[model samples]
Target: MFHLKKINKEKSDYYFMSGFTWLMGYLMIKCEQQKYRMMKIQKLYLFNLLCCLSTCTGLRGLISLEHKVYILEPMEEGNTHRLYRGEHLKLTQGTCGHGHNISYPTQMTNTTGHKRDAQSSTKHVELIIVADNREYQKQGKDVEKVKQRLAEIANYVDKFYRSLNIRVALVGLEVWSDGDKCSITQDPFTSLHEFLDWRKLKLLPQRPHDNAQLISGVYFQGTTIGMAPIMSMCTAEQSGGIVMDHSDNPLGAAVTLAHELGHNFGMNHDTPERGCGCRATVDRGGCIMTPSTGYPFPTVFSTCSKKDLAASLEKGVGMCLFNMPEVKVLYGGQKCGNGYVEEGEQCDCGDVEECLNPCCNASTCTLKQEAVCAHGQCCEDCQLKPAGTPCRESSNSCDLPEFCTGADPHCPANVYLHDGNACQGVDGHCYNGICQTHEQQCITLWGQGAKPAPGICFERVNSAGDPYGNCGKDAKGSFAKCEARDAKCGKMQCQGGANRPVIGTNAVSIETNIPLQEGGRILCRGTHVYLGDDMPDPGLVLTGTKCGENMMCINRQCQNISVLGVHDCSAKCSGHGVCNNNMNCHCESLWAPPFCDKAGFGGSMDSGPMRPTDSSGVTVGILVAFLCLLGVGIIVCFKRKTLLSLFFSNKNSTIEKLRKTLRIFFFCKSKKIKPILRPFIFFDIETMIKHDDN
Candidate 1:
């Protein structure tokens, strides 16, 4: 949809119309059953229109979700510190680490059944970036652009999984080797076999479900830095395993594949401690897999890390629980172990609780019935404390009388007036059960303590007075608002500014509202040399990021590029060159210029054009110039006569005769109608009828 804004009578009034001629064409391919697809397109258009609308309306609040991946040469994709977002991407783009995420505006419509299916089957792999691309190269595809290609794959993958009810996984295929031996062209079997070996797969760890499907795969086919800029191949779903060149660092390929493979199994980040390499803590940031930035820290697992891993694995790849050898060993092939079936161990319900346990998680306990009283005293007395009384013994409040076991009273064992078995101080907090000081909170968008700023949380909003970041709600991730008190690398400062490009040097790829290709190279302060369609009529070179979805392409340019005229002549002509949406254009009459640029010429010569002829053949065909001049007296009498003063010339007399014949015939009837009558003087109509030869 394209929109026009008018400051109507002092207030703004905006009008929206379909800007894309192609949209009309697309709509014609109508499949009523495919409402989801239509809705998505509509949403995308509306979203685009809204951006313009907001700018015109002066509305401040707007939200945008951008999916971007960086195809890093030496490193693996998306860096682990970038934790799995846990939000399913609607689309993906490009490959390797560098690709845009795909979210088609078209897939917004969902029938109830379709929605259910999507929910049941497609769970989000927060860590695995999914980008989309939608083009088939006329020339061979440029597979070297790992990021570009991956984005395309993401789109397809997202659409495929949207309506599926089965659990889907992204598979990463990077090669690896063993024991001080590393050659590239990473082998999946050699590298990945160790991480998720059949042995590990067979140990049933958690709840089991049977919905599973492969969403995507990643492999390496391109360059790896120093060799060439074209360095990788990535699937939109981040599942494409790595296929490294022998010269490439095989370990990097392996890890990359491991990252994507983990996504398939519902792993958000590679390391579970929220950060990587042993600085294990709930809040300490590490690898993206662990919710932290610092990885390569030495130990991969810690007491706190193991527990988190057990839980995540159990939840995401619950099907793996049945992959345990015990389940398989006893029951044909079940991964989960225990006792109760025809196997060595049964009661899987119990072992499942333990296998999934790690330092981060509390261990599950078995249930048993016991006497209410002991030794004639209240058996409950053996339990120590009563259930209702609060225990002030510990700050955790776990020692509350209700849970008091005289044998052991620890922090969390008691209760408090708050959640997380703890409370926040004047400037402290246990956000989502994690503790942080007031200074930390102040640095956060939410900040800490009482109103840091007024009508806001921490500071005044940028440009627009919108409530900045998180006041009571969450603020935008990956960006923070700025503060005056901050300096380079100081507190409360926006990281890289809110508008920096996500990958590399914060330089954004341009999106044009110009007459050009969607994904082509465009340079600032210069016009793109079009390969084919380049019209010379000068117009502003579009210099921006992406044309709005609602805009249409006209003569290789965007349709909204028009004068402030009342109607969109070009836009209307976009469908049919003659008529515009406002209903005006003379297509048949238009000649040299654009058909819609001006009104058509009209005349009252109702079905009329008099034929004219020359009689030069009879007057001057055989005569010399002098002779022809001598015949000027006759020429003057007859405008139809012709004479060539320089050279004798002739005109066909037959044409002249034909013209005269037509002229007389048409002139008689046209000037005035004359009724035709028979020569009745001889006989009246009645007499003639009576006298007719019978």
Candidate 2:
């Protein structure tokens, strides 16, 4: 029930890799019943799903990333934005770089950014302000609260940023614990793992860092409690990002800053490749800036996040900055660098392709697409075409003017590069210029009859999965640009046009048992978000939707999910001990060290004095002797089996003789069998009957 858009050869090639690997594995495993007995059918299914999700989403593990983002939260809130009781509000609309309408508080704005201008445009900043009151009840900072809030914020930011064309990132060192247990690490990579407690990867740079300088892996996060209008308007104005919070968690405030600042760099929760399947992957896990209330535990993205980020670089988007040439790079193909490869060659090989000529040399480079040669690689006349402009706009370009100015521009939005006849994303994926309408990736995920992500590129399974909505002012999917640019979504969502899906991790749909009076408490980790009165009956739609305004979080509000990530352990032990959250159970003193480590033998152990190792030397000596005897018997049997079997030709007869021999060897071992082997013993039946009677 899905129509796959014709992905470019390169994209298709990447997508099919796991399939190839799985197929090969399946074939080889089928032949290995004797060689091995692993990877059962159920395991294979999970493995297949994992592979598909990873490939479709382009998810990366810790090592896959090229750029890392760190969200910082200030411990002190004096300098941050402020808000009052009436001024504070729940999320009202969707925010940038996050997802799933399922995200709590769709939209929020506390303060705006520096204004939008050529410079700000280059800076990739879009401003939206939302006042957060999740922590209004708590008089002070709660480490647990901060942890939860950061997860929500990260999830929100993941989807919002992707949609807004802003990049999303993670926490470097997540500070969580009671004041006495505050975590401070000396390790450079903020590994939340180690000696019984280790760390996770695809990490964002985190450590004590300076605020004035914006380093690649470092960012500032904190809280504020001063101005309301300023915070509300900040989301609109991009002067200096601020979250109005008279009494919000410092973590929330800090993450808000991180989320907003990320926008300043034109990052979005979405990757350059806006496929439904890909976005689903981002939302499946929490983003760095998701709201804290939803997921309050720690979790990190797999390394595939690197690929999503790469797509942005190809599309002229970066953390805190926009690269102009990248726009050209998107058009020219994700390869050929960011500018003119052969002055905008007709084609740039997939980043992996290496070509040698005066035009390009890629022997050393293995990751990026191959570059086009400046000389013989391209036609002299065709090379004159500008990478961004449609063929008609460039001299000697075969593309006609209609292609650029027609009802449909040559390269639609979300598609950065046009390879003369078609447009493609930086992921080297293509959208059919015309005819097909569905987003192949989404349909494959939701199947039929399910509502597609809000503002679906097209309707039905055939609908366009176009990452960027229709380009015209009145396009059906117009929400894409407006949301990305931080503009009002014209009467679409608030009025209930099937509320847009704000992308975020761990969306849970609520089904209340009874209709509440007007107000009810929103429970968050034993904390109440509301006072249980005044507000009308409302149930937040978090499941399956992206975090919208929820992205405007301020800290490392984390949550753990098996779907996203699970804890790691070495040898997973402590004899019969189960490992959970990276912690091993030593059971008790009787179980030495890692509780799963058994008394080096394969048996469930219990603490008792009937132990086998009670008398080490004596027990060892006896065991050795017993084993030696057993080994000698086995060797002797192995040597005699064939010779002994030669005389007992019949299969059943041989088995009987072996059994009798075994019994005699043990019971009547003192009597040798040499005398009984003579042929005269043929009086068989009558002799056996007489012997039995006697």
Candidate 3:
């Protein structure tokens, strides 16, 4: 009941060969079904054998010609961006008091994903800072001083966030003053929470897709600063907003804002109870999350706090701070081939030419000397050669045999013998790889001994390798070795040596060399350090009020000094177009330049999907043909037994044999192959069988 299955034309490039085998098998089966069993069976077996041979030959041809290589296409614009969780991280800020609104310097701007800061990480955080006009007017603070203070605080916070690689931008700024007695006294902290819920103000758009965060700031000049809730309502909370007392100490205010934002990002207070506490004092320096502000300002966060922050950001709890559109950070993982030698990379030869290391393989990013060469010869080929293999030192050098001794055999760089090596060229001694006199060897090792000492010459030694003979004793004496542990120590690294002090522990003493001091001891626990009784207030050490006119204060460091003049269009574009350094307006397609004052129906035209070139088309066609041939072979195998039986049946007369022969010939000819005389030979056999039966 078996029947020939349909072949896939696209993959049937060997259809003619498969058809020929099927025909031969059919004829053999027919021969086996005759009354003369012995003779017919022998002929059938012979015919099947021939078919198998032909099939194997045809299969070999198909396999040899069917392979193809796929070329990678260039990446399209915005395609990689789509791989991110979202397009942008939006941070909405609400400020209290109006006279002087805190504005961030252009250096703190976050229009794109990457942040340029000391942290050396990349990412973006959209910022929208607004002032609550009612609270500001009610407080009635000096506008100029308040504005200056707010700017300082804003600038500080911007730097702090940037250190975490979260670019900060003040995208929205407004004054809200139309309410009744919405006084600063009405608990600005809790009131700010309500302000976030006030949908009518609509100062910022509520786009959950943007992964936004809301932070609010309050300032009261004469009012006493007291305990307040700097709440960050995260996944575990119903709402989120930070309320801070921003009167004096801009540095303190910035720290407070960061602390509250940590809460929203799902970080708990890092106090003694939570496993990391300050050794200097029980109340302070455990982290930015310390319940009480023992010091006016703390510049560092504890290890636990940083760990929690990293986790929060990784878990996507801190809205817009991590994994947002255009933001790249450690959480996103490192990408190879950026040309920079980053973590987890052994080598990065942007183009292949940069790789020149002897044992390194640039293309595969691995070592291949062991696999490619024998013990003594250089790795010039991917096959093992025996010891004493002939080699050349260089293109200009005379040929020499390789010295096969180490794990990887290589030719000696110098022609002369080394220590313990047999001398050559009528010399019985050697020193520093050169043939030497008996006195020279004694001078090199024993400093010109009265008599040349026996076996005194030893190989020169170094930290990385053992010497040929006893040379010296260990220098550092006995000391317990501490394993290297990863820890955040500002710009310092904890690499487990005498000078590399361990950080994030209960007690450690490190020598400090900051300006104004010759040298002093810094005793620290977690991120907080102890100040001596005679020492000045810690606030001065952590905060700085001065910076170059063109620079901004970042973590007490002056940075963001532009290499070139900046071109800003805040006065012209009105937010429609970005001004380039050349002072030219780069407007959106829908708006015209010159401040983007005019709107028009203009945008990009959509083109159809990309199509392959003619060469690619040809490649695809070849692949299709190969597939078709494979499909046909599979189909032929499926009905092989049945076709053989039908052809060998006694009822398959001469006329039926002729018909089958004609059909197979026609099929083969249609496939664009020269018709073989095998079908006619089969007809002749059929005729002979018929005559014998008569």
Candidate 4:
């Protein structure tokens, strides 16, 4: 009876287990099907949204959406999949004047003024981004959301600049939760000026960076969406720009910001006259520097932009971009394969697929075995270069060279001549690592054979406060007259060049005849470019121009260069060196720094030695000295016996002479002749002996 009951219980348990297994299997299958349906629904919703954007936004060539949209979701941890779609929007029609629309003459080659091999090297822009109060409010006053949006915009900008061999590293992000730090107005020019001033006086002192950008939610007065000073990158006063947050999507603002930043990099508008080559057609996104951006946002730079960047760099613009940024201060959290050498990382060459460094293991962001370094100009074959190795040469008259420290795997940061220092090969002063002169400016504007007009022309024509002759526009947007003392700092006047302003079709020549007191009249030619109200007048004399001896243009005034204390700084160089922008002495090739009084391999403390230590030469000198000493010792040893015999012979001749002299004296005494006779005889004998000795 017991055995029968046990068997029945076992059978019941087995049946229950089988039923439970079947139920669990059915539920799992149902869940998988539901997941698939959800994924399909999400994809459909995204497709419909894209279609609506394309139709309403007038985005053409978007039918091939698969090729246009890029998904970068799984790359970021905890971040949802983001779909970058639609063509970049047309934010502004303003053009940058940094290049001054100056067209190079066909006969004049090498317009860049210097070689630009440095363009091939990667440049990192340590960027700081700020969001205005309006932007903060537009994002529901959520600081985290604002920060996220700014980061995303920076990512897009980085993507855009990557092709140009430039990296936009976001070092800091700030949100003005309380209010705007500087005044923000509808006038784009005024807002830009105020923001730049604030950046120079306040933000720059607090946090150091290569450049800064302000994103605002307020719409500008006109069609202008962004503005920046052209070719002013890395400057303390104007290395920044302003962009309006015009689109709900961060990509739109990103494109606008990138356009303005390009202006700072000296890139001009890709106008039809330029005939700029662009890979992307107008139906696609076009190029980043297009004057009038439209439906599709431009994500690529044109050939003109690339050429402009190269020219600007060769002219010493963006001097601070060569050095790598401190990865510790990077805004984003640390992660492997981010292309930065962070804490605990031996080296980082980017992600596994993009990394091309043989010295690095991309999967772990670590250096390969026996590899000392994986990056930097000072690192070669995964090893640090010797101290005094030239890593960067001077690009222009005002630029200084950089060298390797030997101990570090990177070169020192770039330095240049101090402001107010006289420029080399140019009749101007160095300011912000550029030698700006009226002659150079005229040549750029009017092609070749252009010279600055006489002083009388500048004095007479610039006195009138009009569009044709003015210092610049005031805060209220009206032209301001030039004071007599500041006349040279006003609108530039030239005498000879091409028939018309060679800059562009939009530029017109303004001629004025000044009757000299001596009775002859001089003609002054000036330029006016229709660059809109957003840009500063390029016709004005650029700052750092030599308005007078020891005087330079500053804020529309002819100020003494003494104010920069360049003389004081140069005095410390001990007449053997020049002062760099950091106010330190850059020594001569045979002198040491900090004073340049001692002899050593030359360079400033900030930059490594200019020449190598010459270890091989030192070794050769030591060997030569040792060989010379050995030769002298051998000669002395071989001649020892001859020297000894000569000494003994001389001693014997002296002894014989003494004995003969004694015998003569005794014979003279014995003869008893006159004492005078004896004295005469002794004297004769003494003369004979002296003659023999001589």
Off by over 4 Å in 3: 1-123, 138-148, 177-185, 188-190, 199-201, 206-239, 277-286, 294-296, 322-622, 626-694
lDDT (Cα, 0-100) at 635 in candidate 2: 40
Candidate 4 lDDT over residue span 1-694, tens digit each:
0010111331221111111111110000011112210010012222212211110111111112422632222213332223334443323443332333534332322223534366788899999999999999999998876876787678778867988999999999999999999999887888899999999999999999999999999888767778898878999989999998887667678778999899889888887888999977887767888876556656778998988887787767788898889888887656566677899998888755467999999768888999999888899999999888888877777888888989888778889899998884547899888888888888877878999998888888888989998888777778889999999999999989999988677799999888878898889999998877777777789888889999999988899999999999999999999999999999998999889999988899998987746768978879866755554454345334433443466755644654454454454445442232245645654665566677
Q: Cα deviation in Å at residue 481, candidate 3?
A: 62
TM-score of each: 0.20, 0.20, 0.30, 0.79
User: Model 3, range 489-589, lDDT digits (tens) per residue?
Assistant: 01111111222222212223232222224555322211112221111111111111112233322232333323222223333655664433234443454
Candidate 1 residue runs with Cα over 4 Å from true position: 1-215, 218-439, 443-694
Report the C-alpha displacement of residue 333, candidate 3, in angstroms: 30
Give lDDT per model, in order.
0.23, 0.25, 0.32, 0.74
Best by TM-score: 4
Candidate 1: worst-modelled 10 consecutive residues by lDDT: 225-234
| lDDT, model 2 | 0.25
- Please provide, for model 2 over 1-694, each residue's C-alpha lDDT reduced to its tens digit, 9 standing for 90 to 100: 1111222442232212222222111100111112311111112222212210111111111110112211212223332222122113232222321221111221111112321121122122222222122222232454333333433333333333433434333322143232212121222111111100111111112221111101111121221111111111111111223232221223334334554343333223333333222322333334433323121211232223334333323222221232112322111122232112334344332122223333333322222334222222111322322222222111111111111212221222111111111112211111111101112112212223322233321111112112221111222322122233221111111111112222223222221122224765221110011212111111211111222221210111111222222123323453343232223232222443344454532211211112233457868879866755654465456435633663556655654554454443443233322223233332342354355457
- Candidate 2, TM-score vs. the true structure? 0.20
